[model samples]
Target: MQPGFDDPVFDSQGVFRSVMFATAYPGRIQTLESPSTAPTPLSRAAAALCLTLADIDTPLWLDEATASSEVIAYLHFHCGARILREPGVAVRFAVLSDLGAMPPLSFFHPGDDAYPDRSTTLVVEVQSLTEGPKRRWTGPGIRGTLEIGIAGMPESFWSDWDLNRELYPRGVDVVFTCDRSVLGLPRTIKVES
Candidate 1:
């Protein structure tokens, strides 16, 4: 597999900015220009994110169903990331193919009191990104409230999120990808469903 960035140095930085902006302003949608390409089940934007954020030492977990040998080889060749077969271990990042079919919130590492920043970060693929539904977002980065709607996620997601939120600074951060757009849902953000 080849890198999607025409200029690795600048492109990675660009993607990083996109990621930062999305995470900084939770509930806001950001677009990725020249998103990297990936195998089916993984969006171009997601592939770009994996390339930009993950590296040789990053312990990453891919959805078992979507991680074909070729896909794994691509990531290894490009990012040199270590694949974590055991989800129980402390992994830095987890690539998910379908947000609607995600695992139990507790299945991932939420770090410990000593280092909450060590929690896993989920890179999820969703069906659509919209801000039309009657959902409100309020938290550290948000000013007053932000209304956003992410289509194709199971209602159980919010219920699961509620439990995840209870973990406070010890929960996994989430990044949602759909086509050429990406959105971040840091643990600090609260979803008022």
Candidate 2:
């Protein structure tokens, strides 16, 4: 299998910081420059995220399109993350590649009010961040509102996101990845398309 992170410590830290910045400012796109490579169907940003965030204790879930043997092996070897087929509260991180067949957000862990940080963080593979329906985001990190277009999400995505928002502090957070670009959409943000 291929190795992960050219400089495991520094590279992972850099990726982690980029992810944090994205999470803090929803609708913002952050570029990642990881030296690691992932198997087919998984973008460099997504693979970098898995390597930076997942560990022996983390449970990761991969959607049908991202569960290739090579991808699984890479994650296992580099991240030591447990990959499960089922979507449940036990899942800490999820990688989604096929949006058309994406399951409802309710299927993944939402974490309880007391443990919201334990909820699943979704890493979605998309076509482009600069194309698609424009959506306005307003919430904690934005000055007022931020409008951004994200391509390749399913038709039900916004509706599901709305429902997820209704859950308030219990829903999942999303990170969109395309090539080496990444965008964040934390549950704390309000989205209007």
Highest-scoring model, TM-score: 2
lDDT of 2 by residue, 1-193 (tens): 8778888899888899999999898778999967556788899999999998888888899999999999999999988989988978778899999988899898899999899888999999999998988888999888899888999888788899999998988899999999988999999888888
Q: Give the alpha carbon lDDT tens digit for every residue of 117-143 in model 1.
A: 889888988877783355788897889
Whole-model Cα lDDT per candidate? 0.82, 0.89
Clash number for every model? 0, 0
Q: List the residue pairs that clash in candidate 1.
A: none
lDDT of 2 at 103: 90
Model 2: CA > 4 A from native: none
* Poorest stretch of ten by lDDT in candidate 2: 32-41
